[model samples]
Target: MSTLEIRDLHVSVETNDGPKPILRGVDLTVNSGETHAIMGPNGSGKSTLAYSIAGHPKYEVTSGSVTLDGEDVLAMSVDERARAGLFLAMQYPVEVPGVTVSNFLRTAKTAIDGKAPALRQWVGDVKTAMEDLRMDPEFAERNVNEGFSGGEKKRHEILQMELLKPKFAVLDETDSGLDVDALRVVSEGVNRVKGNSDIGVLLITHYTRILRYIHPDHVHVFIDGRVAEQGGPELAERLEESGYDRYLTARA
Candidate 1:
């Protein structure tokens, strides 16, 4: 089975004042078919960990190691990381003004598989994925995320994940800005992909609401720049009840 291992990861971002540390000695492992949820308050480094694993140039890995199946992930370029089967659904998906959604997906699929998918099957697959995600068929012709609502942007991210079929995916606050109906629809989209593929998931969020739908196999409570606690789904219930007050107090 595919495995992603992170050990003692320390990351920092450059600020006006200089380097600001965000992730401090973070360690976690995810295996194919497992869904791990990271719950944390704002600015607790959840997104930093996500972007670091995805090889964002903005976050510098000052220390520690990240590996996928024993291969060094830090050494690979960003595109190499994707081709190696790592996917990150950004907290803010950028608008691509000129690129249609269909072209973007086809290009990504081609690059990942090292060849283009056959035209008829690829077109059919795209159509079916859009229908399942509740997206209008016309969306494929529009520029990716351009003029789309927040919910539409999030839905498009899941659409990419559904099509790419990565070995592992890191979803950053995908539940944000989604209405209850949108949330359920998006969650089902995520579940649809997971059930059909051996895809490991690292889900980052600030609320337990999404947990009701996604059903994380493991939950990690992130406080400050490190993981404060880790447990099963019940941990999420505790957080929802008492909130991060205790953890905040301890950090204080």
Candidate 2:
């Protein structure tokens, strides 16, 4: 089974003064077929954690290790990580003004698979994934995410996920800025991908609404860059009822 293991990870940002720490010895493990939710307030290093694992050059991993399927993930470049079956759906997806979705998808597929797919089969795959996500077939002709709605962008991310079929995925606040209908559609797409694929998902979110659709196997409360509490779905319920105030206070 595919698995991701993070051990005592410490991350920092380089500044004039010195290296300012963000993640303070955070650790977590995700197994195939399990959905793990990482919940935290703003500035708790949740996004940093995702970026760090994906090998973003900005977020420096000062100390610790990240492994995927027992291979050293930190040793690989961003492209290498993706080719190795690690995917990150960013909280804010960028817009590439000139690149059409079809072109971008083809390039990504070629890079990940180490060869270009047949023209007919690639077109069919893109069409099927777009239809599954309820996206207009013509959207694939447009530039990537340029002039797209928030929901459309999120759905586009899911479309990429569907086509890529990564072994592990980190969804960073995918529910953010999505309406109820859009949320349901995005959640449904995620569910469809998870069904029988055994794709380990690490969903990072501040709100609990998305959990209603994508039930997580584990919920972790992140505070001050470390996990303060962890439990099952009930933990998410309590957070909904009481909020993160209590947990933050306790950790403080």
Best by lDDT: 1
User: What tens-digit string does per-residue lDDT give for candidate 2 at 31-112?
Assistant: 9999999998999989999999899888899899999988999999899999999999989999999999989999998999
Clashes of 1: 0
Q: List the residue pairs that clash in candidate 2.
A: none
- After superposition, the stretches of candidate 1 with alpha carbons farther than 4 Å from their true spots are none
Worst 10 residues of 2 by lDDT: 243-252
Candidate 2 error regions (>4 Å):
15-17
What C-alpha lDDT, on a 0 to 100 scale, does residue 168 get in candidate 2?
A: 94
Give the winner by TM-score: 1
**How does model 2 score by TM-score?**
0.97
What do the candidate models score in CA lDDT, each in turn? Answer: 0.96, 0.93
Ten contiguous residues minimizing lDDT sum, candidate 1: 243-252
Give the per-residue lDDT of model 1 (tens digit) for 165-234.
9999999999999999999999999999999999999999999999999999999998878999999999
How well does candidate 1 score on lDDT at residue 186?
Answer: 94
